[model samples]
Target: MKNYWTISRKFEQNMNRLQKPKKETFKKRLQNYLIKFKTKSPQITEKYKYFLAGFIEGEGSFYVGLKKNSTSKYGLKVDPAFSVTQNKTGVVHLIAFMVLFQTGRIDFKSGSENTYVFKIENRQSLVEKVIPFYKSYVLPLTCSTKKQIFNNWVNVINKLDQGVHKTSEGLAYEILPLVFASRTKGKREKSLQDYQKLVLLGVRQ
Candidate 1:
């Protein structure tokens, strides 16, 4: 009887082990969830898309930066970026943005513990994914202020795409004016006159 009971217990343990589900890694689980989410109805997906656009209209930014870089033939580099910021408590939405856009990255905002930012700075991603997505979805829903900013930013990006910024004349006359127009007055680090002076200096060098 003792031997019989021990054998039965061992058999049950093996059965339990065999029946237990395999544990999925986090990446696998996330991929599965995304697959399921994508399989949702088109109406549902469209709603989500519009929701993201509205969220961006409220919280997103379109910006172009002029940073002095001596390594370039031009005195300044044109840095265009699109970003949305949210607190850590809202990180799930930020992740949704990354998944939807198929580009950009989410990171902890500098100097803040509970803040995060989703940003795209890659020129290709900006020109391809970000810009198209905005024009199709976000642009239609944007307010006047944001609309102007987006248009100005797009003009800068188009010039960069044309390789027009390679010449000092292009940087000074064509690109710099657009950059100045894109920025909010009084927010720039240097005056437009200061930037033109730097461009002239670069040509002299």
Candidate 2:
């Protein structure tokens, strides 16, 4: 009877292990999540498409009151108490996360895809860095290997660890590209340069 109990215990343990996500299941889920929200709000999906498509890589539900105000040039007051989940889950949300990081706005109603400002002009550079990394590292991961999905989760956690978590003002921040106003200050600035600066700031987290 003791030997029988030991065999049953081993069987239950193996069953439990099988119940968790396997390598193939994880890959399938990741693909589905990436595809489902490519154009939807909570824009992390779109942002990561660029990351997943090329590079293979790379918040918050806190109610801390944002001391909202317009810096003189931007001439606009920001909203207060933005919400984020990426920080809590430490899970990267693609496009919406970028917009949230920039403007401190989590709600889809506040976002403007057409008007959203970004300074990721170095897209090519990022792509250059990411392509090789994905090819060398992430592309090798798959279901045939033991602990493959587990290893990939660890890699993701490590990557998110490197992301922005604070602003210059010391508020929490994200990786959304920020366009800073040219300090070169346009002389007699008859153009909308200052507004452009605010737009950058508004979009800059």
Clash count list over all predictions: 0, 15
- For candidate 2, lDDT tens digit of each residue in 95-204? 43344233222223234432321112122322343324334544555233322432332232233344322233311222111211111223543233443444456643
Q: What's the true lDDT of residue 97 in model 2?
A: 35
Candidate 1 wrong stretches, greater than 4 Å = 1-44, 203-205
**Highest lDDT among the candidates is held by which one?**
1
Quantify all predictions' global Cα lDDT against the true fold: 0.79, 0.34
List candidate 2 segments past 4 Å from native. 21-30, 38-61, 64-82, 85-205
Each candidate structure's TM-score, on Cα atoms with residue i matched to residue i, is 0.74, 0.22
| lDDT score, candidate 2 | 0.34
**Model 1 Cα shift for residue 94 (angstroms):** 1.1
- TM-score winner among the candidates? 1
lDDT, candidate 1, 1-205, per-residue tens: 9999999999999999999998765456445544643532122277788887877887887788888887878658889998999887766676677777666766788999888888889888898888888899987767787788789999999999999899888888888888878876675567877888888677433
In candidate 1, which residue pairs clash? none
